[model samples]
Target: MTHILLVDDEPHIIGLLERALRADGLEPVSAEDGESALQLLDERDIALVVLDVGLPGIDGFDVLRRIRAGGSTVPVIMLTARSGTADTVEALDAGASDYVPKPFVVAELLARIRSRLRESAGASTVLTYDGVTLDMLARRATVEGHDIDLSAREFALAEQFLRHPGEVLTRETLLKQVWELDFDPGSNVVDVYVRYLRGKVGASRIATVRGEGYRWEA
Candidate 1:
C-alpha cells in the first residue's frame, strides 16, 4: 500500500484530507506540525507528503528543504493559503513537487497526489519507447538523438503515452490523468493536443484507435 503523509495543523483540514485520502484507497499518516512531519518522514515509508505551508514551527519551506537536503526524493505537494506568486515560486524553489492553494477541491488534490505517485513509481526518470526517449527528471524529450522542445502540457501528455507504450489510452483517461480534469469542458482539447504532439514527434508515433483513443506505437 502507498503511504501518504499529511501535515497540517488544522483539525478540520486534517480530518477532511484523511477521509478523502482514505476514500481514494491510500494509507494516510499525519502530523499537525512541521517538527512532527519531519519526524514522520524518517519513521514512515511515506510515498508522498501533502504539506501545508503555514504550520506552527519550521514551516513548509523549511520542511521541504530539510527533506531535499537529507537526499530524499519523496514527492511533496505544498498546500498553502498564500496565493501569491512569490510564495508559489518559493515553495517550488524549496523543492515542492507541486502546489495547491487553500480552499481547493479535495478531488483536485487527490488527482494531483495520484499523478505524483504515478511519476514516482516509474523505475527510472527516463521513459523510452521505439526511438523516442523522455527524460522526466530533466523534463527533456529526444527522438533518434534529436532534442524535442515541448510545452509543459505536451511533455506531460507525451510522458503518459511513453509510460504505457502500445496500450490504448482513452481520451477521458488522458484528460483526467494528464490534465486533472473530470469533464471535457466541451472542446476537442485532447485532439488538439494530440495533434500538437504528433507535430513534434512523428505523426506515426502515436496512432489513433478510431472509436477508441490514442496509442503510442512501440
Candidate 2:
C-alpha cells in the first residue's frame, strides 16, 4: 500500500484529505506538526508527503529542507494558504515536488498527487535531443554533458518538450500535462517556466509561436 504523510495542524483539513486519499486507494498517515511528520517519515515507508506550510513548529519549509538534506527524494507537495509567486517559488526552490494553495479543490489536488506519483514511478529511460539529456528515472537533466539543476516542475516541463520535439505544445496542453491543470488559470506560469527553461536549455531551442504556443525546435 502506498502511504502518504499528511502534515497539517488542522484536524478538519486532515480528515478531509484522509477521506479523499482513502477513496482514491491510498493510505493516509496524519501528522499535526513538522516534528511528528519527520518522525513518521523515518519510521514509515512513506511514498509522498502533503505538507502544510504553517505548523506548530519546524514549519513546512524547514521540514522540506531537512528531507532534502537527508538525501531523501520522496515527492513532497506543499499545501499553504498563502498563495503568492514568492511562496510558490520558495516551495519549489526548496525541493518540493508540487505546491497546492490552501482552499484548493480536493479533486484538483488529487490529480496533482497522482501525477507526481506517476512521474516518480516512471521507467528508467534516457532521452537525448540535440545536446540535452534527461534521465527519466533519476530525474536528472544535462546539457552538453554538464549537469543542469532543475526543479521538479522544470524537469517535468523539459520532459514534455523532449518527448515531442518539433510539436507545438499549446499552453493548455503543457498546463494539463505538466501542472495537471485542466483549465487555464489566466496566469503566465507557462511562459515564466518556459523562460526559465530557455535560460538553461538554450534560447533558440524553444520557439515561441505568436498567437499559438511553444515548440521545441528539432
Please name the candidate that would achieve the greatest lDDT relative to the true structure.
2
What residue pairs clash in candidate 1, if any at all?
Answer: none
Candidate 2 structure lDDT: 0.89
**So what's the TM-score on candidate 2?**
0.70
The lDDT values for all models are 0.86, 0.89
Model 2, stretches more than 4 Å misplaced?
A: 68-73, 82-112, 122-126, 136-139, 150-156, 172-196
Q: Per-residue lDDT for 26-91 in model 2, tens only? A: 999999999999999999999899999999979999999999778677889999999677887788
Q: Count the backbone clashes (under 3 Å) in each candidate.
A: 0, 0
- Could you tell me the lDDT of residue 107 within candidate 2? 98
Deviation (Å) of 166 in candidate 2? 2.4
| Candidate maximizing TM-score | 2
- Look at candidate 2 and tell me the lDDT of residue 56: 94
